[model samples]
Target: MTSTHATGEIQSRDRAPGELTLRAAWRWWLPPALVALLLALLCRDPFAGDWDALDYTVLALRGAPSSMLFGRTLFIYTNHYAYKLAHALFRVQPEHAYLLFKYMVICESPLAIIGMWAFARRLSGSRQTATIAALLLALSPFFVIYSGQAMTEIPSLVLLTFGLALHLRGMQERQTSFVLLSAALLGLSVNVRESVALYGLWLVVAPLVYRWKLDARTLGLTVAACALFFVCALGPFALIYLFDVDGYRAAWHGWVASMHMEEAAHPVTPYNFLPLAFFFFVAAPIVFIALPFAIYREWRTRGLSPLFALALIGLIANLSLITHYSAVINGRYQLTGLPGAIPLVADFLLRRAQARGRDLRRAFWRVVVIVSLTALIIGTPFMLFAWPTIQSHALTKEYRARLALLPDDAVIMAGGQTVAVTYYRGLGLGRWDVIGTGGGWPGARLPELIDAHLRAGRRVFVDADARLWFTDSWRGAETRQLVALQDRYHFRRSADALYEIRPRTDATAQDEPHLERLLAKPASKLRSLVRH
Candidate 1:
């Protein structure tokens, strides 16, 4: 065993310096390097996740109050103060939010791999087990997909795992410094994503679980330092609470409202964990049937070790959260449970072999897990690249082709992807402006905004992605309104699916019947001039 296990007891090293250096390099550097190589292979276009075009609206605030910008105190849109931190520290323009977002996610890849390795090492107490667990995490499907996208999931996972590594080591070693760092990191992680705030429970229990004396004078300064850092880490939320208590309350209510709405989206029941289980073990999900047996044996025989407590609690907390909320869709939402769940995979493998006493069965399953994961891991990027190339080129080509239909100085109004519209506008297509529809149909302001666009000598392009608007509860009504708006404004479908909202040259009757006829037709694949 390495010196790390004994918690302040160092074993004398008989190994040469070169051997130690090589071991150190492997321990700290190799896993991260491999994760980085994987990310580099798939970081290009058709990136895994996309920026919520809605969230980007907050950039217009420029760190001001939401009330000041949008006339709302709740700030229902999370600005991701973490993302704004990039703008403050790195001079990233709000227009380039996706760029900064992708960069931040990419940066988390190596740290996340290292943290996963350390966490597995601490829990399993076997270098072999640790290596396999870290490999599972690094090769995880969601991790691979989210690594290059502008999203909060992977970033939160990185901080959560790193903090766990620190806290677990701190508990075992009775190291106040590590616990302090862990507290701070966990605090900062809450700011990154509210989902991890429950992880704070681990912070409160660690000291007593480790038997660290509260009355000890030597620990007083350490306690103070810990408190100070923890508070400092929560500085962003604290400021909001202090200065904008009303706004903070509004945000809280808004979040709860959103949770309720999400929960209402799907029929969430206790059985939700069944799918979550399947998702976590997706690489070789059949082995997941063994999870309960392994968990029961570990609990009955070994009891709940403090080492595994965080992971168990984390998994339970996430499941409890989803059980209450209707909107939990994928296993990706439950990723906080993944690091904790990984050790069980190793446990299942180790125990299965011992149960049958057949090395071949264990080895075969291990190969199956790896090969299945390999198929998913390698095939996903190829598909991500392949599907997007065709879809994007078709979409872009369609956008460009309709663009030629408009006058040269036409000012186009778009709902989403204003950046892309602006880019095409640069190629003498038309001027562009965002006319947001609250991710749905434009409010009563549509006619006024359209008239404004026309007054500026620009043909109005009313919809950016009418399809995305149908995802929520407003599907039928919004679609009906789009049809109505097309009829009312005498709009025509260009070569593509969009409506051209130009000022009328002739007063045409509203074609409500034609619009209804178009809607009643069966949906099919988009006919594009470009072939697959």
Candidate 2:
């Protein structure tokens, strides 16, 4: 009787916590989902808040160019078809389609929170710890901001965290199917955001670090499954490289040229440390505060758990890559690693609370509440008030309205707002050219191009204060050029940050043949003149 009871106890203890009843599952997940949904709806921005938001929007609304499909192909296509489906099924108006897309993006936040909860639950085996971790992520300003934007980051984050959860579950149970599916999800995530490649690196190194030699057959199966799934998921992109080599090359060159321009404009400095600084100080300061304690506890106990190791690896790899390569340190980049780190922080807090007794646990909960409320208080106002006031939103709205007022045949000589103006004018419209004074063109030549356009009987408009043209390296020269152009041409303020260049009454028209030749140049060639 005693032996049977002992065996029963052992089996019950070893059974996976994941096999929860439906009611129990709901209890575990519902709070985080509700909180995430509420926050996402409250913070949602009606406009594209980031520069790349409209780029992606345009690609989705219209099909992508061959060169554009070289990266983020899945994200682009998914949004494209999603919009089509919504329009077909619901008869959504074209004007309201972008708003629908934004709402679709917003829905990813709640899904991401649920993924985080599952990942933390699998990692820590404590419902309370997982809930805390989920809440932490839901409240993170970085997560909240990106969640509301129609961008790749939050969607990729959803894939990554869910994959991590499945990967952990598979590793613990020695399940080949789960491991392979996780590998496939991770591979798909890389298609959305290349930065997620580092998470795959951690998974590859994990088996060796954890010493899974005791389960040799399971380990072999895991390896083969991962290899097969990754190949299946990533093979399409490889086919693109092989089949359309020219397109791939064009995309690669475009990316490289943009990187060079950004580097020249921004200039690398000690400020490169900003990504790491933001991760530690701003994104989740409470997590960092708890991390040292977690590390010490793990070190003193079992030499650090594999869960903690995964968290550390993810955080280090992501921060290191962004710090080294990215021209600007965006706080949103840190969201890539929080799925791993938040769980560790939660586990540490819960364990410490359990060990120290009731009063200390109450104190810890109070701290968490304080931090959550603080982030909510600060983030809510910024998203509601300050975010809409960002230059991208204002500029895009102004350009859209101004473009409507301009003559259909008017030619726009654009600077920083080139993409915004181009997008608003509709892609088929061709009466526009990016100002290329800084891109190997002599400043004096700008007037000649303007004269050519004016001679062709086209009204020329300029966005003189476009921010992209005045990066640190080119600001001095660009400013001098702008000042000289303003002196020579009578500029009428057409709209915010936009000016109409009235041809001087004394100015003579340039050669008709020269004007015709200038106007005849392909739009692509004109666009290429700017660094892009």
Candidate 3:
């Protein structure tokens, strides 16, 4: 086995003698930036897609209260403050706040690209390898898609890659300040997205990978560093608790309970690893083909560098956590470790090209071209079709117009679109009764909740076609509550699957006939009305 430290050894062997000039650095930076800009332009949408996007948009437009800052407080605050700054300085109108926020968030893509370059360079000690890795990540379809959205994934990734880069560099240079800064950035990343806390495993395993002996002082320092990491991670939450003790405590408990419930709902099994496989094969085919070979080659050559070990550990930890608890398989979930994997693959490919003259070098270029084209081909359809289709379901002007048609005093009962709907038509406009069906209340108690609203002489408008409430595939408590609601009240289709709920006694001759006709439709037909 090689005795020198992994990253330091690589740097000593491969890096150019002189520091990279501005012109050379710009050559590396420009491609990823241009690619990100092009993708952002193509995938730009005024509205948010999916539940989290909508929730984030609402939080950005309206500042996140203590109740809303469960896992992603920093990300929410970042967007919120950005919006506030734009509104104050740039004179951005309220109507355009989300659009501005979307672009601002999208900017993280280029920053992430640059961060990946720095990280990969630090790992492989080759600017060429780093550039290739950055471009590869820039072209990633899932990365491109998420980049143009108002979400935390890309920002978290940006912080994570940069933090890892600094940490690696600090270890290489023996700089305590760099290490401490890396810890701070990592902690902030945990605040942005709690999923990043998984990377803490990498930090713990890192010293051991560098072949540090398991002695008392080493163990004590490791423990102290980890303690510092946790303290930094929890610092924002601590401040939040200090300001709003009850609210923070309630949110924390609720988040923990939801996590438990989610864990129970999606128990870990052998099949859970399928998503990790899917991430490699479907999401990043190049990495799928290259990473194993890279690991094998590196293992045989230098006995597994700290860089390779970091990548492998990060990939395993992230994939394990996601598959164990998350019900859905998403490419974004794998992104935290994807940057790390890219460096290893890039280093391997570049090394191969250098070692084997002409033909193998041609093969390396061919692989890059093929992989880039494949990623674009796979991602283009999603960028053009799937993303827009999802965004269409957001609280667009059309949906808002339909909502405006309802009585001024009407209370909206929504499911997944609850945040968006409430944001558009909630207490700000004096309509404070947008009840979310996902309030964790019992289905049996749904009637009692509705009865109170009705007794107060407010008309209740239920989103009958909301996917959460009406999907036949869903057999959750929400669906049961919807069925119970149907059996108890006479539903008058107000506009585009929006139904006005009234008591059975209140059903006049005109209402009764319409209600009967609506009820006569088959279950499939009713579900067909859902926009999903």
Give the winner by TM-score.
Answer: 3
Q: Tell me how far the alpha carbon of residue 483 in candidate 2 is from the true structure, in angstroms, after superposition.
A: 3.4
Candidate 1 segments exceeding 4 Å error: 1-36, 43-48, 53-97, 207-233, 244-290, 323-327, 354-461, 464-477, 484-489, 492-532
Error of 2 at 257 (Å): 1.3
User: Model 3, 338-446: lDDT tens per residue?
Assistant: 8768888877766665454434336446656766787877656544545534455554434566667788768877655566566565324435367764434335677
Arrange candidates, best TM-score first: 3, 2, 1
Candidate 2 local lDDT, 1-532, one digit each (tens): 3322332332344245544322456676788778888877776665765666777777677755234333677787788788889889998754455576677778888888888888877776656667778888888877777777778888887898888888887877767688888888888887777677667765666566566774767567667766865674567567766765436666756766766665665566676565456445456767766776766665555465666687777667556654444424356677777776788777666555545443433634764675577666755543444453343465664565656656777767555566566566444443454554333334657788888888888788765443434423354455456556755666666666556787656344221111112222223221122222
> What are the lDDT figures for the candidates, one per model?
0.52, 0.64, 0.67
The sequence of per-residue lDDT tens digits that candidate 1 reaches over residues 1-532 is: 2212221121122123443232463754475447654763464324224433223333322443332212221122234465567668988764455555456667777677767776766665544455556666666655665566555666677787878778777777777688777778776676555666666766665555556677764367356545754574456665665676446547555655654554554467766665555455542242344446656655665566554465466566556655543223344565566676666565445444434533434543564466356647654654454343224423432455555665565555443344445445433345545453333235555677677777776666544354323322234444456555554566655534455675556455232224443345332221121011
Q: In model 3, which range of ten residues has the least summed lDDT?
A: 509-518
Highest lDDT, which number? 3
State every prediction's TM-score relative to the real structure: 0.66, 0.80, 0.82
Model 1 poorest 10 in a row by lDDT:
523-532
Overlapping backbone residue pairs in candidate 1 total 3
Candidate order (lDDT): 3, 2, 1
